[model samples]
Target: MSIAAVRIIGIDPGSRHTGYGVIESERGRARMIAAGRISTASGTVPQRLLQIQRELAALLHEFTPAEAAIEEVFVNRNVQTALVLGQARGVALCALAQSGLDVAEYAPTQVKLALTGSGRAEKLQVQHMVKVLLNLQGAMAVDASDALAIALTHAQVRGMKARTDALAGGKRWGRA
Candidate 1:
């Protein structure tokens, strides 16, 4: 018998509405556990960041995930929005660090490509693929789906890395 693998929590950080998702993988399979967004009422930027940090900490404790995958903020057409997203991501990192969980980052293009087989696929297409792959039925908010997609992408990359390392006879991280 083998020990069970742990789950991962994925976060899509936004100052106004930070999205989060939990996923588990074992024997080369990935599944979504939960996904949601946390939004703070109108407040100052620092206050909003603090609220996001507190919420992230609570979520980490509740989920008890082994690791975290966070979507990296890319240069966007909207500078202000990007800045706010950066702040939210910082808060998320802080929470993960406090909990002593490892954090990984992925880009949007990478996430889209991993989930939909095409980086340029439309948002609806990505969402549909997520629902189909996860076997989730009926309506799901786009933000929730996006968060799940991010988690899945990280899972795929991590799986590929494991295979490559095995072929090259490399040791797995954090495994003795």
Candidate 2:
């Protein structure tokens, strides 16, 4: 018997550059389908958010992913920056919710730990692991690579849950 593939989308939200990646997972394996950034032009906050919604809507329509994983907003010393980041994350969450995708939020530490076995791993380390895991070539933009890392992390975590659920034979956890 063959298991059907599950499509997952991951987003790294930012007011100026929201990165997205799509992947297909099956039987504990995952492969990248597409990855890119949604670059919003300089404008009012509402205007930028609208652009993000439009772009994300189109991607959701195109892939219709089974689930989505996003990086949770990490507050920094800069209050303004943290607020803006939260807003961007809200917009992203709305977009995914509208599509009815099962969304999972992971902290930066969780993502880093999943990818590099260290919660404090550097960006370059995460990027290199993503490239290797997906068997991709050439350089990848940091934001886009981060999105891919989120997707991969989701797949691994969910895949483990699925197996455990199956072994328990009570009820399956993920989407049916």
Candidate 3:
């Protein structure tokens, strides 16, 4: 069976700098399409949220991703920090939902485990595995690499689900 290629968008939402990555997946393989950071350093919180929305909207228009995967917000020791991060994540989710993409949420540890075989893996390890898995060249920004890892994890997990479903239904799995 052959699977049609699917493009997926991954987001790592941050109040100061959000990372995004687009990837194409077919069967069980995934490749990076584009990855970058959305910097909102020069703006207020509201302004930054607007910036994230606008940029994410543009990416949705350009990539037309079939699905989206986002890193679930983690609780920080600082209440202020957690609140700000949640706000950023909310904006990102809103954009994706408005764009009509099916959004999947994954914990940071889940993403790391999917990529590096350990839930407690460090960011550097996740980044390195993402590079190796997608066959990317040169240096990737840490933020972008993390986003790519999220996308990779989604592709892998979704693909597995598709296969499982197909098997349960007594049919061959193709695209998901």
Instruction: Score every model by TM-score.
Output: 0.89, 0.94, 0.95
| Candidate order by decreasing TM-score | 3, 2, 1
Question: What lDDT is reached at residue 158 by model 2?
Answer: 85
lDDT of 1 by residue, 1-176 (tens): 22246588888888788888888877667788888888876899999999999888888899898978888897779998888888888888999899998888998888889988888888899899888877888887776788888888877777777776676668775566
Tens-digit lDDT track of model 2 for 14-97: 999999999999987889999999998699999999999999999999988999999999989999998988898899999999
Q: By TM-score, is 2 or 3 better?
A: 3
9-37 per-residue lDDT for model 3 (tens digits): 99999988899999999989898899999
CA lDDT of every candidate = 0.83, 0.92, 0.92
Better of 1 and 3 by lDDT: 3
Show the lowest summed lDDT stretch of 10 residues, model 3. 167-176
Error of 3 at 157 (Å): 0.8
Clashing residue pairs for model 2: none
